[model samples]
Target: MVEANVIYVLVAREFKKFVRDKSRLISTLVRPLIWLFLVGGGMSRLVTPELGMSYMKFIFPGILGMTILFSSIFSSLSIIWDKEFGMMKEILVAPVSRFSVVIGKALSGTLISVIQTVIILMLFPFLGIKMGLLSICYAVAIAVLLSFCISSLGIIIATFYDSFESFSVIMNFIIMPMFFLSGAMYPVNKLPHVLQVITRINPLTYGVDALKHVLLGDSGIVDFPIVTDISVLAVSSLLFVAAAGFLFERKK
Candidate 1:
C-alpha cells in the first residue's frame, strides 16, 4: 500500500506539473499536428500506400506513436531535472524501495505520454479516419503499453546522464534513428534488407504497427500479426521496467 502510494504521488505530481506547463503542452501537441499535415501531406505525394488507405490516413497511427515516442522518452527528462536540483537525492533516500521509485517514475512518464497521445487521438476524424469507441479503447491500451515501454527505456538512458546538454546530444542520436527506423513513415518491408531487420528490432515499430492494426482494421496491409505486436510490447515492457529498476538500485 505504501509503495502504491509512492507511485500514486509521483504520477499525480508529474501530471500536475505537465498541466501547468502550457508552452510545453502546446509545443508537444503542435509537433505532431505539423507532422501529420505538413510532412504527411508532402510524403503522401511520393508515397502512395498499397494499404488501401490514403497516405495521410495510413500515417495517422504513426503520428500518434510519434507523440507517444517523443513525450514518453522526454518525460524522463524530469529525472535529470530532479537530479540537477538535488531533488532526486531526497527521493532516493526515502523509505520506499528503489523498485518503487522506478515504478513511480516510469508510471508518471507513461501517464503523461498517454495523455498526449489521447490529445492527438482527437484529431483522427479531421483526417477522415473514424474510430469507434472500442477502437479508441484499444488505442489507449496500446498507448499505455507502448508509453510504459518507452518511458522505461528513457529512465534507463537518463540514469547515465547527469545534465541536460549531454542528455540532449545522446537523445538526438537516439530519437531520430528510432523514429525513422521504426517504419513510421513507410512500410517496413520496402526498406533494404538491413534496414528491414533494424526496423523490426525497434520497439516503436511494434507500437506503431499495433496502432495500425487497431485503428486501420482489416485493411489487409499485412504487417506483423496483432498478436505478435501485443506480445512483443508486453514482453519488452517487462524487460525494460525490470532493467530500469535494477539500474536505479545500483545507481543510488
Candidate 2:
C-alpha cells in the first residue's frame, strides 16, 4: 500500500509540473513537428537512397524514438532541481523505500514521454505517413518499453549529477551524441565504422529499429529481431533502475 501510494503521489506531482510548464508543453510537439515538416521534408528530396522506404517513412519512427529518448533524459533535470532545492532530501526521509522513490520517478517520466508520443503519432498522417490500426498498439507497446528503458537511464544519470546546470552540460555532452548516433535522423549504415559500432551499443538504436519495424513496417539493412530488441531494453532498464536505487540509498 505504501509503495503504491508513493508511485501515485510522485506521478501526480510530475504530471502537475508538466501541466504548469506551458512553453515546454508547446515546444515538445512544436519542435518535432517543425523538424518533420521543414527539415525532414526538404532532405527527402535530395536523398534518394533506395532503402525500400520513403525518406519520410524511414525517419518517422526515428523521430518517435527521439521523442521518448529526449523527454526521458531531460526528465532527470527535474530530479537534479529537486535535489538542489532540498526537496529530494525530504522525499528521501519519507516512509517509502528508496527503490519506490527511484522507480516511481522513472515511471512518471515514462508516462510523460508516452503522452508526447501520442501527440507525435497524431501528426504522422499529417506528414503523409499512414499506419495500420494494429500499428497503433505496436507503437504504444514500443513507446512504453522505450520510456521505461530511457527513464531508467535518466535515474542512473540523476545519481551522478547534483545540479540542473551540471546535468544540462552533461545532457548536451551525452544526449545529443546518443541521439545522432542512434540513427534518429539518418541511417547507421551511412555513418563511419566507429559510429556504426557505437550505434550497435546504443540502446536507442535498437528502439528506433524496433519502432521502425512496427510503425513504418520498414527495417533497413538492420534485421533486429523484435524479441531481441525488447529483451535488451527490458534487461538494461532493470539493471539501470537497480543501480540507481543502490546509488541513491548509498547517497542517503
Candidate 3:
C-alpha cells in the first residue's frame, strides 16, 4: 500500500477507537472546564495581575494548553494496552514502516486534541474573551504545535512502559511536574531559581507561552518573552516526533 493510504488506515482505526469511547470524548472537554472553573475561579482573586494580563485572559491559553497536553499524553497510554493485548504486534507485522505507526498514532491523538480545543473554544466567547480572524488562526496553529509536542512526548514515554499501572505512575510523576513548572497556572518568574531553570527546560512552557501570545493578543503578557519560547517548542516538536519514530521503529 502507498504511504498515504497506510497513514489513512492507521488514523481511521485510531479515530474509530476514539469515537467508541464516549467517556474519553466527554472527559476531554470536562477536564479543562474543571480546571478553568475550579482552579481558575478559586485562585483568580489571589492573582495580582503582575504578568501584564488579566486573570481570565492570562489563563485562557494555559487551560487550552493543559487540555491538549493531557489529552495527548493519555492518548499515548493506549499503546501500552495494545502491547498487552497483542494489538501492537499485529500492527507491527503490517507492511507499513514502524515510523508510520508512531506518526499515525501521534497525528490521530493530535486530531482528537484539536477537536477538544474547538469544544473548549466555544466557552471563550461566553467568558468575554475575544479574538479576530488572524488571532484565531494563530491560536489554531499553536494548538496543533502543542498537540504534536505532547503526543510525541507520550509516544516516547510509552516505549519504556510495559504495563498500564506503571505508565500511569510515570505519567503522574512527569505530567504533574510539567504542568506546574510549565507556567500553566502561574508565571515562571514567580518560581524560585531552581524552579526557574526547570520551567525553562520544560517544553510545555514554550507551548503555553506561544498559545498565550496568539490567543490573548500581542499586548498581553509583555513580561515573558515569546519568540524564543515559540522557537524552542517548534524545534522540540520536530525532535520529539523524530525520536519517537526512531524508538518505536526499533521496537519493531
**Highest TM-score against the true fold, candidate:** 1
Q: Number of clashing residue pairs in every model?
A: 0, 0, 0
lDDT for each residue of candidate 3 in 35-137, tens digit (9 for 90 to 100) = 8888788777778466554566578778988888888887876888888889988988888887778888888888888888878866777666787877877
Better of 1 and 3 by TM-score: 1
For candidate 2, the TM-score is: 0.93
Query: Which candidate leads in lDDT?
Result: 1
Candidate 1 structure quality by residue, lDDT tens digits, 16-129: 999999999999999999999999988778777465677888889899989999998888877988988899999988888988888898999999999989989988888888
Misplaced by over 4 Å in model 1 are 49-51
Tens-place lDDT digits, model 2, residues 1-252: 228889889999999999999899888878677777677888888774776656776688888888898888777557888988999988987887988898889999999999998889877676566778788888888899888888888888888878776855776777888888988788888899988999988899988888877766644445477788888888888888888788878853
Regions of model 2 farther than 4 Å from truth: 218-221
Error of 2 at 239 (Å): 1.1
* Prediction 3 global C-alpha lDDT: 0.80
Off by over 4 Å in 3: 48-54, 219-225
Q: What lDDT score goes with residue 48 in model 3?
A: 43
